[model samples]
Target: MFLLSLPFSLASAAELKFTNADESRAEFERSVKPFLTKHCVGCHGAKEPEGELDLTTLDPDMKSSTSGARWATLVEKLTKGEMPPEEKPRPDAAGLAATIDWAHAESKRANRNFTRRAAYENGNITPHSVLFDPKNIPPFDGESRVRRVSPEIYETFLKDAAKRPGTNQPFSPLGGTTFKDMGDPTIDEPVTATLFRNALIIVEGQTVHTVENGKIVKWNGARELQPLFDPQVAPTDAQLEAAITFQFKQILKRPPTDRELEKFVALLKRNMAEAGQVVGSRYALATVLMLTEAVFRMEVGSGQPDEKGRVRLAPREIAFAIGYALTDKGPDSQLLAAAATGGLGTDEGVTQQVRRLLDDAKTDKPRILRFFREYFGYDKASYVFKEANSGGGTIDFPGHDPGSLIADTDRLIEYILEQDRDVLRELLTTNKTFVAYRTAADWQKKLVEARKKFDAEKKANPEKYKNREFNPPVKMVCEAYGLSDFPEQQPVELPKDQRAGILTQPSWLVANSTTFDNHAIHRGKWIRERLLGNVVPDVPITVDAQLPNTPEKTLRERMAVTEQAYCWKCHQLMNDLAYPFEQFDHFGRYRAMDSVVDIEATAKLEGPRRNQTKRVMQDVPLNRSGLVAHVGDASLEGPVDGAVELMHKLAASERVEQVFVRHAFRYWLGRNESPGDAASLQAAHKAYQESGGSMKELLSALLTSESFLYRVPASPEPNAVPKAASKKANS
Candidate 1:
């Protein structure tokens, strides 16, 4: 009778249109309490609760209660019949339906209140506005600020400064995280601090010494500012001004305006009055000009917007942009000449410069190598920690170091670019690889020669060779005699069929692995996000994501837990994509078994060993079946058996080609693409397809696009009242 009366009371409350907090609380007390007492209180009551839920203490007001989410979860469990455990008493059909309806209504109210509070706190309905949406994006607002020189460009600039005609200071490279300089706009305090610290070091003559041949050698390089200040040749006032002008041109990449020249000259004169002329000039160049934004940042033109809401970049700005896009240094003589003649302001002029820069051997190799290094991220191999004692240590085979692996990858990229035929496809499917150590016989011969030379030197001069650095020769001996140490740098050719493309390289494999094991998820995520242009959502906060560590079972077998219904929702997208890499171990060596006996065990027993842990080989079947989905192109989406097969499919994919072009756009533009950038992207893609996938042609198209050449100013807000209208209304 009581249960039947509850629905009637709820109906009456509903008819009364109860909306306020007090009224809603009253309704919940009358209709919801009876249901919870009868069906849920046994397991979820005050004394002892199930799943950390206590229903009796829960507040009737869902919006104000912290337990509102728990109520919603309970409702879901009841709806799905996952609760009550099949043996416990279950609510009848009508009773269950009533409870579910009330829970859902309260949940919606709570969510609405939460969202409203968040919006109020943030001062907007959305915290962050999307910068780019394919359907709608505003025109480019030539609103770029003077950005600081990137780490790479700054290092090159410093090296060049040290090599100037009168300077004798050895350049000390600055080190810090360079993400901000590399187009990440987020302000980093560390990078800023590092720049300031390095500037001071360059200004003051600090003694920098190096240890050579067991003796400390002091380099007086920092004190020798002979190029900037020569005591033997005292300059007149006019000569000093000329010298300052030359420096401004070199450091800022442009001759200073009259006002800037006047300010700097005054600074130099004040310093000279206090100290000597040499000290004054050094202080002005190092501490003053070098720290200014003119030297640190690449500044474009700034002026009032024209009728079309557009502005053109200054000629000098265009020259700097073109030069930095192709090389780490400032503009060359030809580029500076073009800027002076105003020839860099047109599409045809820009194309000619781009062609010349691309063809120049000085610019081509390093730019292309750096581009691939950033794109593939295989350079991270130098930093990734790998365990030497584990089976994965096989990557240290005969004649390979992390550095050589990186260089080999760079060489392969250079080779492909030279071919200029379907470059992306070749990168994905090419099987040939360059290596420092190739055939067993050649490796042995080099090792023998190095060992013989070391033995002869040590025997011939016992006293002189004492405390000599013998590691290099010892490492060579190890490689020659089939010992443990990896060989040093020397190029050789690997068998063509042993590898296929960048994916199969040791550098990439080591980079994406943990110290003792492979992370298939990370590898798969990279391919999905980078190559396929698909996004994989982060793991849910509520989930404790971890795979079981079962030594007896293979990695694939242990990963079967992801096949469960709840976990499969997200894991299905990543696990299958990464499965193909199982053929290679964590250290990137191909193996039929999951673990292999340590081949360097004999070398360890012979003398002091690097890794002393015992190793055991284990046989396990590797599953290489993988699926590529959401490619839009149907032909490239399906199951694959191995890394080679996966690469073949990727090579044939149109989506892959588009993604490569998109990455190139981002790399050169130093920012993500916007809706306004669609025309530029399309032009580059068209160029790639038309020119038989030539990267040079694609770059030319991007540089000549309207998106790169012009910029529009931001529009005024709609709510803003015009000054003329306001005055007329007042009159």
Candidate 2:
């Protein structure tokens, strides 16, 4: 065990100058022991030590035992006024301060000795501190490095390379907590092997031959690569160079340098000489350029450094950065032209490009939508499974599909983004939403009439309508779902009071809930972490967090078990925040009471099915009273009656808007926020406030900020040579 001796040694040296150990021991016995006996010994003494602390057994000599760390904890608790349980006698202010000071002094001495001893044993010492200051953060040096392309971006790049609308081939999906792909790429064995396999498949074509039951079952036509490889006639040297340049531009978003071009040209020539034309060219394209770092990694910045030890991003890099920030695709022709002419080098030029991109209807604004999906975590709705043969079918909707719910949420988000109003506030409080069915119109009325007539005729004479089919009015749903004609349906507007913003949306409600019942804890935890930026500590390992399956009690009543001191310590921070969402059922349908039901023994046998079981459901009055705190805004932190009221308060919060700005910073920069990026974050926030919370304005400000425009060199060795200088020296 690590031991501390510095404090006692220092005390001894000081005592030799003025006093003696006998006087110090007498003072400790008179003051410290009496204080502990009066205020701490009851719960933390010999008979039954609380928190495993036995203050009575501790040695009076601070450095003789391994008790300095325990002393530090004691000091922290006393200083924070968390010791001396509420019913117990409290320490006087002077006494508390003096004790805390002594403990601190002892802790420092012990820490100093511990550091020296650790360095001697481990060859290094690490600093430990409880305080953090933003001013201590280092500035961005504007260095740039290569990062791998994300899965989505790689697909887009492949489409551009193949000169097709899309290949429709699947790539491996990235995994993370957020729906957004922020995973760092690794050149692991599995990754490289997968890349090689994909490269070969793309170059050759997709083909399928299936045999089943000892028979030749099916064969599909192999995918043709003629469109991608066709040059119309035998290729000339200039034609090959032109093709190489085009491919380079398409994949890398820039032309190859002369050196790179020469190397590739030599490789192409050698391949052509050995294998003739088509086969060699295909092999070269697949194995050489397609597999290079230039195709897979986004390498930004020219090595030229300014006086401030920062480097400006290459003009092309600026264009690609701005383009990728707004959309999944690389820079368009106009952006590339601007970069080529050095027009993208200034703030004004970048602002112009940003505005143009945001205004472009063709630009994939879905990328922005995707950020919100990941930020809110509503996308998890797609994977939620409801049991078909379970008790309490009270919350069931006949046609409620998780995919449709997610799509509806996306539509609502897209609508709000298109309007470009107070984006954060609107998302929190807007009542309007799109449903799976469109609003009823003249065609809808006619379709309804036709459906009614058909139903009547079918009821009267089933045989007459057995072979007949009915068409509905909507067009897009039919097309979207791959139906030959519209289905029978009419859309209904949601009740305004029953719903509000994203919080009440079925996507969020269902995603955060269990199969048969609501998960108030999950809902509250999401709001606390994602919106308010407050972290909830993990439950203790000793605690079993499950609720008892009591048929008589409602979920709220059962959850009241957490009100006990041991459980309430952590649950208090979450349960109150989640209580308000009790207004909505597991399926997000508004309800006045909690559905209570007895689970049949056979319910467990039912697996991964939906809308099959029926059970007697009793209504229990739902207690929707909830408390909201730690939002970092006074106006928004208070008791709320339900989800609607909570949303109203959140909509008015400045902190909510700031949280959104931070999320945007993470989304565009592909990293978390740092103190060095504060200026950019502030500018984005300012733009949102000044422009009435226009998302486009925030994007423009962020894209033009110093953090986005420049980078520091990856290596800072004084004698390190620049890439251009190194190339010249090699030549």
Candidate 3:
């Protein structure tokens, strides 16, 4: 659509298409020489050849030389959109195109004789080739990087250690804690210590129907698997020695050092001789402590058992890893002790262990329940009202007269396993729990009374409860169920939005709050950091500043506008996210309408704003906007078809999958998966999808993947700077 123009003097151009030298010279002068003279000669030609590049004095004969390559390099600069100097006299589009074509033609002719280079000559893989070229990779090959004798290896090691006829024994929980802290091992601590972390496992079962014809035929077996970790369970005097030796071998992926082996023997002998019992619980506890170390941490191995890089963990260790990762409490001592005695080796014991792990009144009921909540981003299950089933379980609410008690653990598990509904709906909407009313009525009554009393105390003194609400109450249930409590409160709800989800829960409001301030900066930051995983560093402490207290004003206005500047520096991000939860009252109960005068609904969370506003003035609480309405499975009526469909949609999304994978990676790998790990992660992610997102399958894939078992750190690359700019400046 556009006409062309060119000037003579093609000889000066660096690159040009030509049938011969004469043709190239003509093309260069006619199409490229004039343009360069007008736009580039002033800086690089006669007066000053910046970076030693002079377009006006360009030599047509030096076609194969590096100096002749400068013009071709300039064309690349223009292609990348980083040139034109912004203030310089730039060539028009057509002129630039002509230059580009000429440069490419000359480059091709000049590079014609260059031969392709072969791979490494000595067979020693170069870093560049090994990383950049997949085919050149030889160092890894699974056997080299993938260490054998994971927890699976531990089983053999334990057997060996136990048979070694040593004197060291396992630690006991009854006598006292025997496990030393992983971060600090100066003092022996209980396995139930506060440093425990829980692992999350989501299960989805697909019903496979085998139909030969139209009529129903038979049901295929149900494939069930879970993300499991093996814990070191060695209790006997000899077992302790074997466990340490085995741990060293597994961690190092080779034989243990003689010195290390001797140390293990010495430690075991001392423990057994001092404790006066080789088969005591102490020996088992000590072994568990060793397994908790970083060396024992394994990635979700390859999705399949036969994967080349798969990291294998022993069965008991798998159980321990699952328990430790999923809950604040470490491995269940009872389960470990049972395992140490080899009771879990039989079919019945294995089944019992699975059931026991899931049925342990201490961990399964409360700790596992909390683990689910932690994964779901909620502190507790939502309330729900459902008629008790035919399951025989007495229900009870202690502290409250005539409270029903739930006797069976199965009934309790069923009541909480409704994965379709958000926990908020289950906790606030449900009033019924499968309880053996007659069996646990008295205990149930006491608990109900305590809750009622707690609720009454909160209502009587709004100020007292205001800062006390948020996730604390749900956490209390966890503690009562024997799980270690995090004891930190987080604002989970907005004041305007009732339903006591976060704002009113006892754990969230009081743990980090002041008696007077409902939403203190400290509490707000804690909620953002802990609940949302936002890493908001702490602000420097200063003298307490008096904040305005008005019924009409939101927390932000009262703090930022009235408070000093030192506060806003850090409060900016906190206010953006926290203010949204103000819709919830202190008791976590949502109110459709509040009778209080000068009703206020202004709060914001901590994050950068699009408008770059200094204050959170325009944002409205979630309740007022109807964005956060009551949601429940029953409310949708009938079966949760829509919710299931939505979940499928989320699971299918790359973003959602990434979130799950990231969370799972952090759990299994003990650190954030680096971008360099993307290859292995990509492979594992593919396996996960292929395995239908089965929690166990995904974990298997990750554990077996190269990134999980290998410990090689990624190398950094040097920053690249275009050579054209350097040459131009020098001229």
Candidate 4:
């Protein structure tokens, strides 16, 4: 889809200072001004700018002005390649690309990225009423979208798409943690490099190279390639068909259409002619590995349109959606069977298949647990670096490392989901916790099994395994917590008074904390947005966000700077919401008092000259109070004593439950919630409430809703980027 229209105000643009010294402004005037004046300013000029946007007077300094957001939106509009009204002269391709790059760079300076902006708005910034109202749904047409698979999902995709299972080097496009949870599937050349490299890697791994004489043909090569690489003989039409047919079964799960087969045959023949038989087979395989459908989850419906101008997704499409939503792998045999029999074309059929996947205890549907991991943000625990002596001086809390805490949280989520009752509420208020815990029996059994394998291998060749120790890997617990040496009790019942829900868990606290202190703002921000369905605007461009680093003052007292008139407008939404978390230290240990360093209290002259000074530690009573303001629901608003109490109050709020539903819709749908999605959102929320908060009931209702099942395509236009093929595996 294209933005088509963007509304910006130039009211403040004229007030900014601009001169020859301002290189950015100078470039804008010289290079960008004419492009805008010709293609944009005619309709968006001072006389009567369309959508209240005056491009002629638009500010160039996007880094420190309100124009940043508008500029970012403009970049999105241009990059979408659908601007210029679709009737006016198209932009100069070379100039257009330069302008987009410049605008995107400026947008980054102000920390506004529009690629993921739509999903963010739908999940967080949209008005709660607009997304949840029963009477506010759009017509029964689906917005076709493509969601990018994550690196993990891509690994699974490779295994399912081709016979290849693993790669030598891990494939990461951005090379860091820059990706948002569910980002837009963008069309960019940068991805071409990542995709092609990985595709080549897949093809190379599958090819078994045996450089013998051409006369020697052995079973050493893979059976799939034997026919294609027959000694000294070119592949025949029948051989090509057989080769494609085998790949279809191994990878695509269904026979390729005649057109698809023809294309593959042509590609194979071309590659064999250009390169030798063995080399050409690898090239042909690489082409198959690069198919966009194998890399991205495509949701464009294939069936014909109905009387209501809606298109129902084909059985295969529905199965793929259900499978991708629930698991990283492709549609299982059962799902494929359902699609083959046309069982996925109806609402009941989709619901039944989804429930079947949910019911299978043996199937590790990590996506279900994956949602809670992202939803709670406990998955980030391992990444939040903390010095050994950051807050609490001692490292007594060594057992509950970030990874273990996240695993414990995952197990906790799975436990709650296993019960499938009051899931959201249970996640917020449960006192059950796992501390350096896993099933000891299971651990011992694994240890014995691994030891046996190692001993057998080492015995087979003692000199070959000279110095290697029998150190087996563990999961969901600390590697050094000594599961083999000292087993921990499972699912220990933490004190209800100290720990209630996941909010009070050590993992959550540590993930949201700073390296040197507790991050009340981050903690508060999570609750305000994730729980209350409210948004806190980004910190202003003009504000210097650093707090006073006075060790004598409490964290709260030092944070008093945010209460200043200039800052409180946004901080008021987060600071108090986070204040309740102060009862827990930066290490997440519950405390009635804060551990602080008071230089005067610990002052001592200890040198021989009696001039050297030392400062010892002291404690101050903690202020663990928080306010629940502007929650929309009057009953849910008030002052709370601690994080647990605040969480309990939030858990009881209907708005909280509805917000949870809205987020789930965004996560599973791989897009933002629209006015059209209100019906689905409302139904899912209602299902959760009516079925005693069963996630099964909620997902069933959501998966079967019109938003997931029907597609209402927009009217065809020139230069519209097809959503399905463009999407990659980013999520």
Q: Pick the candidate with the highest TM-score.
A: 4
Cα deviation of 689 in candidate 1 (Å)? 1.4
Candidate 2 least-lDDT 10 residues: 123-132
Index of the highest-lDDT prediction: 4
Model 2 has how many clashing residue pairs? 7
In model 1, the clashing pairs are 166-227, 167-227
Worst lDDT 10-window in candidate 4: 5-14
Better of 2 and 3 by lDDT: 2
Which tens-of-lDDT digit does each residue in 593-697 have in candidate 2?
777864553255354333444555567678999998644356777898988888887778776677677667667776545445666666788889999989889
Q: Candidate 1, overall lDDT?
A: 0.60
lDDT of each: 0.60, 0.63, 0.38, 0.69
lDDT of 3 at 543: 34
| Predicted candidate 3 versus true structure: per-residue lDDT over 1-731, tens digit per residue | 00112222222233434655566678778977877777667766776455445666665533423233345335534543334555786568667667756765664455421111101001111111112223423333221121112222233234433322232222221111011111111223542231121000000111223445433354432221000101222245345445555544433333456776676666655655566432222342244334434224432332234333333344454445444443433346665666458654444554455445543445533433432333332222122122232111222111111111112222332343434233323332232333232344344455567688878888899886887843333333332222233223221112221222223333333333333234556544543333322323323223354566664555545665623464554454355434433443332222233222233222342344423322222223332221111111122212111112222222333433544454455444433333345565556556666755544445555544555444432222232223443232222
Ten contiguous residues minimizing lDDT sum, candidate 1: 119-128
| Residue 580 error, candidate 1, Å | 1.0
Model 1 Cα shift for residue 699 (angstroms) = 2.0
Tell me the deviation in Å of residue 559 in model 2.
3.0
lDDT of 1 by residue, 425-523 (tens): 888878665554334345556668877898899999989988885555335323312234543543333334445678877778877877766778778
